[model samples]
Target: MIEDRYSTASTLYPYCRVSDQDAEPRRHPVVIVGAGPVGLALALDLGQRGTPTLVLDDHEGPGAGSKAICFAKRTLDIAHRLGAAKKMVEKGVVWNVGRVFYGGEQLFEFNLLPESGHRHPAFINLQQPYFEQYLIECIRVEQSKGTPIEIRGRNQVTALTDKGDFVALEVDTPEGTYKIEAEFVVACDGARSPTRDMMGLSFDGRVFEDNFLIADVRMEAELPTERWFWFHPTFAPNVQSTLLHKQPDDIWRIDFQLGWDIDRDKELDPSRICSRVDALLSSQTGDVPDYELHWTSIYTFQCRRMQEFRKGRIFFAGDSAHQVSPFGARGANSGVQDAENLAWKLDLVLKGLAPSALLDSYSSERTFGADENILNSSRATDFMTPKSKAATIFRDAALDLARDHAFARTIINSGRLSVPCVYDGHAHFVQDALTNGPEVTRPGAPCPDAPVEGGFLLDNLKGNFTVLAIGFDCSKLKLIDGVAVDVLCIHKPSEYLQERYLGGGKSAVYLIRPDQHVVGRWPEFSEDKIRAALLTALGKEPI
Candidate 1:
């Protein structure tokens, strides 16, 4: 039997009344507007840091349908930091290879992770509901250990006022209404954000005219666990494109591009949907396979984002801050990264360790990420749904050449699958001193994971602010900018660690941020340079 994990009938967090609902407006260090993946992840980060945080959600539990099925490696790494990757990784369908086809001809197949030493696979396919469920469960466990995290279900934020120093919020509940205040408000509400509407803000970008028929089917079939994207498939000539993905359990996700002028109601009919699925199956197995429809929906996407993610005391993350086509699996993956980036900065600002200006970097850095996702998603959408005659001709020509030439294979854009955005040039940019080091671990780039003697390199750099020494000794430096830093000195580095961190040099030092991004790197240990980099990262002056 197929289970609907996204159904609204499930009440993971039941309605509950607290002192804040009955008394004067209660204040918190941080208040999250939505309890989706982004909000829950942000709460996990802040709460684990001992920050008083609360989450407000209109629904009782996970939403209906398996919305996002692709979770990237960087996302898993962030989840590992928040203590919620085990269940997700275990329950998800892990895959690293992908095959692209053009109308009965195989163009090429590629593996996202060709090298070893990484802790997680390239990507995993898990329903969005399961993703949220694991996070919510982690929150419950953290609460047991005295993490000041509170989640109120059926509580909707109706209005909010930014008072400069803080923000006042009005929330409606099943019973009545109440008011609350917070030093910071994070909007993780989905694309049609009520918080954005309340703030009188909107996205600025292009909205393509195309519809996708998404069907989640439950059936027993023998199919390889890999991503299969087809352009101009032979099975259904009427369909422009098709995507097949393996989700957890026996369910499979299939997406059909129905173009701009599609009959929504007629296409959603069970017979019509079944026929489409049967056609796809007949091509693969030469027979119609029996299957049950677990869920079905039609979606239209837009590639857009706010000019700025932060405005006053209220901040935005996830879909509320940006919206991109679902072609690249960038929507949820990028949102999780946004939560990670904002959580650390907010922690520092609320604790008075760094200037409030540090928060500005969050906007600048994430907008950089949002723009990358938008450009890639827009390009993928255009490639899939050609608008001009020249575009179609070019795409077809590239596909024809892909059957023989490898260069043409690179030209086909079937959703450049999500990868960690290497923020090489963005605000709070720090110059790199280890010029000979691997470019993959340069400043503003996510730390590459490598196997070490103890476990993994990422596991060793365990702190909001970490000073990682690969081959030199730096036990004397403990704190930077008056904040404690997790200084990890490894003199006897393994080959993997030396290759990733030190590159061709004998030794190197790196200052990494709370989100595990390298703030700066040097060939030798220098206290003054590290201090200056830390200050620069925090948007403050060097001592």
Candidate 2:
């Protein structure tokens, strides 16, 4: 087993023998290989929908260190649907404003979320371990309610065979080995996924050469909660770029960009890391290094992914399917979105409500999402580390002008923060017959949250196909297959809701997917158009 290295997160799941060890190979509806945040979140999504899911992991609980700390609003929305966002939002340090600096001068600042109607904030700085812990706790809550979610700690998959209709899995435990079969298998094992390697699939993309050192120090600092980033700050002469974020429990995250080709071990020395931290503290606020070192590591960025996410009964999700630079916080957010996209489709297929072809959309849509993230990540990496002299000259010029010019500030690439992938113009979306609706709620886009009667609109779209009737009455008996489309009729929407959903119009209706994405929207509700749209969205009819 791999060591935790420098993590103090609690071991929420421990090894336990299951009856499958002794009995013949047991068959399950679904098997997820990995119990990290991505795996656990996928299991929770499936189990919450009453689908039987088994999750296996090599380790006992969350992995080492604060890996992905920036939880975007899109991620929180997905977590809220999976019943895992309450504690996370409560314990996290929420922020929306960010300041950027270049060469010891402030280069303006920006707010991620200026308008307010959503339930969650624009972003939150929470440790990765705490995020996984909250997801496990929510899974435990579901298990108590008889949700068919089971986690097998210390159970590692040794072999997997795609047998067309099912997947045969051989797992290793402390007690020895055992065999099992699953109708479908999802690999969320991580960037170096053994599952993808076993399948002999290639994860193709670019790996950036530059490296960055991360230090998580526990201290009561006077820094604001906003994200502060610098390009060639005066405090640290050796550092090329730096990033600072305030995490919960008085722990702060600091990253210093050390250009490629350095001694990894020597740079990780206690005194070396402390010197950098001390320099920043003393230069900024005239304070010494009065903080306890919590964790330290160095990492390079890789913008890579498999060509496709599905191969027969086995599918890939999260870091297993794709890997991106940490900038923009796209890695985990996109992974969670992969789970959200795959769960509803898998649920319908497992229940025989939709044709098996519906599963293909999971791969196509998420692959598109992965490509988008990789493109952005690659651009950010290129912008930060300009290869040619000409590119460096241009970047510096832009940074110089960004101090006073607004348009120049727009060109600054300080890791564009993560945002929801709008599946706009995708073929899967039914062409909206009802014209002149809000583009934010267009087909294939993530439906924007707004104030409603109870609390928020997203709270009502957790686990089923929905017909959100705004400022109108929609009593359509929804069906593309045998699945029933639930309807939420809002006869009188609040101004926020009307502006977001209706585009200031009086009446509109929307078809929403289980993952809170818009299937289609119309000015008025019609049974025929809605039914046709369901068929198109479900892959039963050609769009």
Candidate 3:
């Protein structure tokens, strides 16, 4: 049945034959270590760009359980570019409203999608298994179109050695062991990363002693499609907090805060889990429904990242590069962004279109992203589990004030939630000559989505460097020597477009990267200025 959800062929690719008697090793353009969302996404991006990619996973099929349920808007946008967002959006539970409570008292409720010019919603709640299934489908479609993306299961990378020009990998499979070489290696192996350990890399950051119990239950229940978070609920007095989220197929995800001194084995007992779930359910509706326990796991909070995401020909993405507290759903969302940021750069480098320095920008840009996720996740964890007596006092006082005063509601931290990180101060961005534009659509930010002629602006810019001309003719703009540019002209701009791109009342030209990040913008289109910005974005020159 699991194989039915994700096609059997989708999960298993023919294992390559590697005899120890072979004279030379088989070489690949890119080898991705893990088949999780990040690795699969990277493979899809590269494959669509005509790069041959080989994905290796030890498991025989997609993962079990609803691991990462919350996918942010920016992540969906990336999926859209990869041609995988339709099924993800359709099968996922979309929730734009969230309510935070202190005990039985409601503090405040916030709306994430207050205004909408974008095609996707603020966030979607889909099980990680389903997410991976959709991505695998996308990969298979690309492969059908002659983009070589090989996904081999039951294959494990036992050893890795950087050879400067290429990385040598020893893979252990069911049949036997084999050796393969790749121009680049992307490690998406996850938190306990073997590749990271093989490289002798260390993650540096804070780890909270607090533990959390995540339970996924399937039952028919009448509940609003919204996120509900509680601080010090009455039913679970010993627990610090609780979170409730709805998913597809009448399944619900509930997270309970278990303090530092919890008994790991004893707490994970089925009877104990049932009791905990019943207690929370009774507290809400005074009755527990007949529910099936689909999955349960306990994990500690950690906010750590590698010093650098890249080392030689071996690159790290997803959980291999960074780990964060699940409070804000930053782990998977940030990982997807990492894959998007790196795939394009790698494609260019492999095609000899840019220098190797282009890869360094991936490190700089994604490290900036990882740092932001770490900071927000750490702050949420500290608020949830106060480290010191003063912190605990402040947290309690803030909750008490939240019940009475509207201003105090801002202090509550159930979770900050995930949003795209703007690479504002990074060296890759070029500012406008007049330095005037909407703050949300400034250079280095993910291009804000707006409705254009046929579809959303993001739809047109998929997998290509774009020149967005607003109130200006882009027909005369010449392409750079090594860069292919797709020119999108807005003959009549909408209010949202005008507000986002023409806020300064000037005709503007914007250079957008293949990843849909704005490289720079100018009041008037100049061939030389745009070319210089393109070079700067590729990490070759200063603008």
lDDT tens digits by residue: candidate 3, 244-325: 8999999999899999999999989989999988998888777998898988889887888999999998899998899999
RMSD to true structure for each model, in Å: 2.7, 1.7, 3.1
Clashing pairs in 2: none
Each model's number of backbone clashes?
2, 0, 0
Model 3 accuracy (lDDT, Cα):
0.86
Question: What local distance difference test score does each model get?
Answer: 0.88, 0.88, 0.86
lDDT of 2 by residue, 1-543 (tens): 433323446678899988999999999999999888789889999998889999998788888786889898989999998888999999999887889989678889998774688998877888888999999999998899899999998888989998888889999888899999999999999999989999899999998889999999998888778888899989988678998889999998999999898999999998999999998778777888479899899999999999999999999999999999999899988999999999988998999988898898889999999999999988888888887899899999999999989999889997887887888777668776556777777888898889888899899886788988878666756555688788899988988888888875788888888888888888888877888888888878633
lDDT of 3 at 181: 93
TM-score between candidate 1 and the true structure: 0.97
Ten contiguous residues minimizing lDDT sum, candidate 2 = 1-10
TM match of model 2 to true structure: 0.97
**Which has the greatest lDDT?**
1
- Model 3 earns a TM-score of 0.95
